[model samples]
Target: MKILIPLDGSAGSLHAVDYVASHRQLFGETPVILLLNVQWKVATGNVKLFINQDTINDYYREQGMLALQPARDVLDAAALPYQYHVSVGTPSDAIAQYACEQGVDQIVMCRQGQGGLQTFLLGSVVTKVLHLAECPVLLVK
Candidate 1:
């Protein structure tokens, strides 16, 4: 199974990682796990002019890695082998796009992320992902 877990360095997000690690037998033949962190574009408009593209890319990579680290640690403790990537875009869109790009079989993620008021006001990444994703999604809650 090609399982993609989108994390945001939040405790809620880590639940999905823990669930997958605990239930590896369900996937058969050792699941192919992929971790992803989508960083919001920080260098937009005027910010882009002030900072070079390379610097902005580096910022995204650095923040993405930091967000992905906790999930990586969870998988590492279980000795699960996986690949990860950091993307700069909207969370739900980036997740769905990455899943399609990787040809993943499933997306396993939390029902909600760090967004509390923003999520309630603007809808959820999970809801958008469900609409946008072609593959099945299993939310860890």
Candidate 2:
């Protein structure tokens, strides 16, 4: 099975990583794991003119790596084998797109552990991904 986990370096996001690492056996075999970190487009309009595409990509790569490192560390400590990618875009869209491109069987992600009014008022990536993804989506709290 191909399992994709999106990490943003937040504790909530890490929960998904932790859940996957410790409970990988549930998948029945050593599943292929993919870790992804999406960086928002920071350089816009005139900003792009000054900074070259390579520089912009470098910035995204640096930030994405920073966000991915904690999740990587967790997976590493648990001895889980995985591949990772960094992309620049809206987090939910990027995650869904990557999952589709990679033809993953499932997407496991953090729930933000928020509830009721808080969750309703503050929309979350998990919610968006649940709606966007064609594959099964799992929520880890």
Candidate 3:
């Protein structure tokens, strides 16, 4: 089975990674794990005009690696095999797109324990991903 975990460098997001790592036995032998971090498109047309394309790409790469670090550490410590990717786009859209492209069997993510007003105002990524993803969406608290 191929599992996709979308992380945003939040403790809540890491909970999803923890859930998958801790429950390895349930997924059969050698399940494929994909860790994905989506960096918001920071370089717009105006910013691109001022900054070199290579510099902008470097900036995104740095930020994306930072976001993936904790989850990577967890997986590494557990001695689990996985592949990670960094993409530039909206988090929910990028996650859904990647999952679709990879043909992931499941998408596991966490929902922050935010109040109704805050969640409604911000429109949580988990909610958007759950709606957009084709496969089953597992919520880890």
Question: What C-alpha lDDT values do all the predictions have?
Answer: 0.93, 0.87, 0.88
User: Candidate 2 lDDT, tens digit per residue, 1-141?
Assistant: 999999876777888888888898888798899999988788888997888989999989998899989988988898889999998888889999999999999998887743458457757778889999999999886
Q: Candidate 2: how large is its RMSD? A: 2.9
**Which lDDT tens digits does candidate 3 get at residues 1-141?**
999998887777889889999998888986799999888888877987899889988988898899889999999999999999999998889999999999999998887733368468768888889889999999998
Task: Rank candidates, TM-score, best first.
Answer: 1, 3, 2
Which residue window of length 10 is worst by lDDT in model 2? 113-122
Global Cα lDDT for candidate 3: 0.88
Provide the global lDDT of candidate 1 against the true structure. 0.93
Per-model TM against the reference: 0.96, 0.89, 0.91
Q: Which stretches of candidate 3 lie over 4 Å from their true place?
A: 113-122
Worst 10 residues of 3 by lDDT: 113-122
Residue 64 in candidate 3, Cα distance off native in Å: 0.6
Best candidate according to lDDT: 1
Off by over 4 Å in 1: none
At residue 138, candidate 1 shows an lDDT of 99
Return the TM-score for candidate 2, rounded to 2 decimals: 0.89
lDDT of 1 by residue, 1-141 (tens): 899999988889999999999999998988999999999888777997789999989989999999999989889999999999999899999999999999999999999799889788868999999999999999987
Q: What value does the lDDT take at residue 73 in candidate 2? A: 90
